[model samples]
Target: MANASSMKIRVEELESGMITAENVIEPGTERILLLRDTILDSVMIFNLKERYNVDEVYIRKNFSAATVADEMRAEIDIHQSLSTLKEVFGSDEDKPLTEFSKEATKQISNVTNELITSLYADDNILLKMHQLQSYDDYTYKHCLRVAMMSVTIGKSLDLPRNKMRDLCEAALLHDIGKRTIDVDIIRKPGRLTDEEFEAIKKHPQNGYLLLRKNGSYSEEILNGVLMHHEKYDGTGYPLKLRGEQITYLARIITVADVYDALTSNRPYRQPWSVAEAEEFMMGGANTHFDYDIIMAFLAAFAPYPVGDRVLLSDGNKAEVISNNTNVLRPVIKILTGENADEVIDLYNDFKYLTLSIKCLDKDGSTGE
Candidate 1:
């Protein structure tokens, strides 16, 4: 039997199953029992005849004799409790902000990993865009979106995986300091005074200190929080480190942060169109952002994402149903006077095409 530190079991080994209580066993307790490898694939828990929710179960040295029926019962109880918590805390009415914070942080990490992997393979951008659009709260959604965009940009630039993960973690935690800022300042629907703006600027330091106090994150993560606002031209705040003095991860994150902020609806201003935001970023390149990172970002972002409806230059309407192999061109489903879902491959039909995204609708749906 493998020790807990290096426990190994195949999916087939867990077919018969064994029982182990995650909570009942002490932290250092080392008892081996036959268990389904749920950690390998959490979805497998639903397939098991018996369920256990204590913590985790491990395979034992015995060949084939173990009972997991009781364990499955415990799992059901735990799952029920979790479901209750989700219903109560995740309700639209008035859930506590603390609970929301925890859930948001968890989601940020999960989405960051997904986004990083998606940059290498062009599969899930639409799903991710929809997930981002569904969140009602701006802070959580903004942080998660920025982290995703930053990780995508990093991967497009061919950064190493470990470095990219660190950047993602940093990007996810970048705005955590906002929790320390005054609620009034953060939620203000109008333009702030110079003093209020200064107060808001302190969030990076506040976030860095909060993470430091927690004593769990690495220095690079903290630095990312501290320096993400710094600019290439040395006009940024706090330390004001310019050019190469700022960390590479921080540089990448800054571009992503600004792009998301501009494109996302805020209390003070309507969200800018993706094309408008792209133009703004292009103008800021080399002065506020690293030019190469900007190039990578433009390649990664979809100005007219799939599933969005848009109005073409010819006055006909269409829905963007898919992206072309190249990121610049997308496959749009044109909706003319009588036809719907007429797939138009922009790459092949360039001669007759002069369409552009006017703006993103409230649901991020487009028409052209």
Candidate 2:
């Protein structure tokens, strides 16, 4: 007889004669043994006795835990940076654009580089980055999220370092013009009136002016600010540059902007799920967004995100344990049956079982 601690069972090893335990049943112990086929619901554990009969039972396997502390720390740092930006922007005293000073820019740039390096070290950071809240300081948070998301997508596309930094800077300053807009309109919880929206629409041009006024930013950076809103189909605002006419940095920032807008909760409505937001982008592909950038964005993002619990197609609850080798699907551990507390590698087994993620449970932590 195998010792409970060392006992290993394969999926194929499960059979009618096997007796399972509510927990990890030790050998030579008097724990109740539950029949395999008697299991019901999903992702749970049950004890069975020797007299019980079985036909079929689902058993969950164990999965390794993913370390997400660094990811969470990165998220907190990003949020803090945004908060600082808002405080600096909202002061009653008008600091001249020239007074904006290059030191702060240098500090932001250094932080950006550190953040990119941290995120690249762990793919899990991408999901945690998405969970950042858009507070009253939406402008700063929006800029940071855009910069991070753009860097993520750009790196996935293998853009060179110089170009990626340019993209990051562009994303960071994409909404600098919002400083010139009325705060009430920018933060209004309801649908904007035409005039209000028109005011909001002027941000791109305003941002371009502000950056040019500083006289420190390059034309590449300024162009990114002016054209980030341009759509692939020429339906977007400002200059309405179409498709390839939009700078690559602008195109990248556009996707990031749309993604952050959809995922961050607003006073008007709750944020969309990561999967839902990605689907929205899919619907807009080739029309509102660049197709390849969208693809790269999808590859770099976790729809369900690690650490979030989800209900599986098999009617079981599982925690996302790790990202799958394939970007679209993640590996989850069954947390609820005879398989309760076991890890399931959906990527390896579900191919034959036709299993897929059914729904996400919002209650669980995204683990770090």
- Per-residue lDDT tens digits for candidate 1, residues 93-211, read 33222322444445444545655665566644433433343214666666667777887788779989888888988987787766676677776777899999998899888888877
lDDT of predicted model 1: 0.61
Query: Candidate 2, residues 65-179: lDDT per residue as tens digits?
Result: 2223443354456556665566545542343232344665675566567666765675444544544453345556677778888898998899987887778877887887877
Candidate 1's clash total is 17
TM-score of each: 0.56, 0.65
- Angstrom error at residue 45, model 2: 32
Q: Give lDDT per model, in order.
A: 0.61, 0.66
In model 1, which runs have C-alpha deviations exceeding 4 angstroms? 1-123, 302-368
**Among all candidates shown, the one with the greatest lDDT:** 2
